[model samples]
Target: MAFSSGSTGGPMANINVTPLVDVMLVLLIIFMMTAPMMSYPIDIDLPQRSLNPPQNLKDPPPPISLRIDASGQVYWNNSPTPISALRNMMETEVQRDVNNQPTLEIDVNEDADYGLLAKVLASAKNAQMQKIGFVKK
Candidate 1:
């Protein structure tokens, strides 16, 4: 509480915020002291370096090649395979290695039809083949 003192005015009521400010500062200090202690350090066992050479895991299989000639003819593994067989072939290849999916490399001729290339990509995706890359001649 505060009062106004003047030559010709009555006493005026005013709120003293000093106590509120002190309480807020105390609460801030309490939070700052306790915030750090609230967190606990986690224990972890990290991997150690070994002197022996690392053993080779499963060898990566050869990438399956799909070639599209200028005339829009599609070839699977250098052999003529129709567009209809692409999905089935891709599915079988994926099933062969369930753990590591085989990579499919599409080699498209410079003059190959865009529609044909799109169809090939769609077929590979439909078969759930994840690793598909383009092979530039």
Candidate 2:
């Protein structure tokens, strides 16, 4: 005599919620697993300096560049100079700058003899050039 709602065959209504609950739980677990790996902690208190940067940051022109080639030959500022003469010249330069010491930059090629490079460095020292450095190229 009377009609009811959501009851297809009888007087009972049922809904299947297992699939929807499974999907929601799977998504929650995925997010939980990935949240910890997303970001890492970096602990450091970096110091800040108020000093002005130098004008020639890349490379500064040294007083002299002593180059030793593969053939056991040396050049003083792109000119041929014997080790003895180079030593003497450096000695003279050092003497001229009595108050402040001048620096020498030695540039040795990869194929250059190691012994020759050592000798050149020694000569620079003997000439009183204390601030000596090697060039990468």
Instruction: Point out where model 1 deviates above 4 Å.
Output: 1-56
Per-residue lDDT of 1-137 in model 1, one digit per residue for the tens?
44667775767676778999999999999999999999999996676888995576587789999999999899999999999998999999989986678789999999989999999999988998888899887
Quality of model 2 by C-alpha lDDT: 0.77
C-alpha lDDT score of every prediction, in listed order: 0.89, 0.77
lDDT of 2 by residue, 14-123 (tens): 46688999999999999999999998999965758859855544443356878888888888889998876877888787887544566688889899888888887788
Clashing pairs in 2: none
TM-score of each: 0.58, 0.52
For model 2, the superposed segments whose C-alpha errors exceed 4 Å read 1-62
